[model samples]
Target: MIHRLFRHIDAGTTSYTDETGANPVSSYTCADRLDRERRTLFRDTPLLVGFSGRVAKAGDYVVEEIDGRSILITRDREGAVHAFHNVCSHRAAPVAQGSGNARRFVCPYHAWTYGLDGTLQSIPDGRSFDGVCKSAHGLSEIPSAEKHGLIFIRPGGGDPIDVDRHLAGLERDMAAYGFDRFHHYRSLTIERQMNWKLCPETFMEGYHLQYLHRESVGPIFFSNLMAFDSFGPHTRLTLPRRRIMELRDRPEEDWRLIPETAIIYNFFPNVTMVVQAGHVEMWRSYPSGDATDRCKVQVSVFTPEAVETEKARKYYEKNIDLAIRTVDGEDFPLSEAIQSGHAARAHETLIYGRNEPALTHFHASLNGALGA
Candidate 1:
């Protein structure tokens, strides 16, 4: 991949699709389209919820509400991962809140307790009803699995997650990163006034780096150049940094791709995994509510190893801060304007240039899924 990227830089060419693609503006601005996507893409599919390191120990759990559906992910005593709907069997109250280690999740609404495995442990007052079966009332399980250091859940719940099938052939590349051992650094959730799809689109292509991010992160990377490939509905982009040119002088045996450039894996629908030089970043975007014009994005950073010292924590903190500033301050402002333009009816369709093949593939896959 690095060699291909170097050749692109040397020839002033970039990876491109056969031709330009056009997508209807309604794909972003229509509520009906958003609803269909939430059903097919977000609920039925195995969405990337988080990393394995977040729930590294027994009783550790995290609660995340994606696209308005609350999900609970837990690690049991036997070192197994599980996911649930987070709603209590009694009166539908959320059994888990935020994140922490707890042997039991007790619903604040009525004290209905659940085990780490999501089994209903006990009722506040047993025998209130004639014959309510505790075994049948456990938290509704959401199809989940842990793979390649990542946690995925199908919110609507169905068959068990087949990690290899879900990832297609991208598992081999993801396994190389050793993400299971990567330590969580920090995360920020920011509300954006834009469609959910538009959020990840910003990271899909390098075409805008030299112009949009010229003063921020542009100069560090080669403009409009990347190594792109697709695995099923997913896409992988290897964006070469300007410094990658120096690799031509070094021996091929010494070439290291991970540290030399940014590798982005855009999982179908809504997850983006970016492998940076020293750390990894995961971005998850979801619709804010029923609205097509609003969405929320969570950006989390991870270090190669756990931070044991204050200095190490501060170092990663600064890294995440820079990332937040570059996206929140620079990229988002324009995305918001683009969203506003859609509302203004300036154009009925948005064109994806051949150079932006990742965006083309993303929208095409999204539309295909929605239609299916």
Candidate 2:
């Protein structure tokens, strides 16, 4: 992948697709389309929910809401990962709130308790309800699996999650990163006034880097250049920094990609894994409350090692600040304008140029999943 990026830099060319692609404006404006997308792309698919480090110990768990589906993920005492609906088995209220280490989850609504494995452990006044069977009232289990140091959960239950099968051949490239060893640094949730699809699209193409992000991150990278490849519906994009040109004077065997490029892995519909110079940023976007024009994105930053000192925390926090300034401050505001434009019906469709192969592949994959 580094070699491919070097070649693209030398030739002043980028990866390209066979042709251009078009996505209807309605894809981001219609409620009907959003509903279908939530079902097919989110519910059925095993999404990258969190990393292994976030739940490294027994009883560690995380709660995340994806497309309005409250999900609870936990690690049992026996070192097993489990996922279930956050809802209580009693009156359908959430059993847990945020991430923590807990042997049991007690519902805030009625104090119905559940074990880490999602079994109904105990209920307050168990004899009060007649004809109620505790054995059949365990928390609703959802398909979940952890692989390659990444945790995944399928919001709508069906078959068990197969991480290797879902990743296809991409894991061969990801194995070197040792994602399982990464330490969680920070996490945040931000709601943006744009379609959920627009959040990931900003990272897919470099066409606007030199222009939109000119003052912030543009000068550090070449404009409109990317090394792109697709594995099934997922994609790996390599964006070389301007410092990458320094590799020409170094030996081929010493050409390291970690410090000279930004690698972005798109996990199909809603998740993006961005590997930066020293840290990794994971983004998961979802439609906000059934509105096509509104979206919420969950962002988490992971470090190669645990941040044990104040200096280390500050260093990683600086990276997060730059990301917020570039994406949240610049790209997102423009995306909001784009969403407003789509709502106004200014154009019937949006065009993806041949040079933007990743964008084309993503939207095409989304359409295929929606059966459109």
Per-model TM-score, in order, reads 0.97, 0.97
Question: Which stretches of model 2 miss by more than 4 angstroms?
Answer: none
Task: Give the 10-residue window scoring lowest on summed lDDT in candidate 1.
Answer: 315-324
Q: Write the per-residue lDDT of candidate 2 for residues 84-133, one digit (tens) a residue.
A: 88888778998898888998998998898899999897878878976788
Instruction: Please report, in order, the local distance difference test score of every candidate based on alpha carbons.
Output: 0.87, 0.88
- Candidate 1 lDDT, 1-372, residue by residue in tens: 887887898799899999999988888888888889888888899898778888888999988878898889999999899998889898998888888999999999989899999998998779785498899999988888998899888888888999889898999987877889987776778899999988889999999999989888889888899999999899999998888878889999999887779898888879888888878888899998889989989887888888889998788777677777888999888999999999988899999999999989998788788774
The lDDT, on a scale of 0 to 1, for candidate 1 is 0.87
TM match of model 2 to true structure: 0.97
Q: Which ranges of candidate 1 are over 4 A from the true structure? A: none
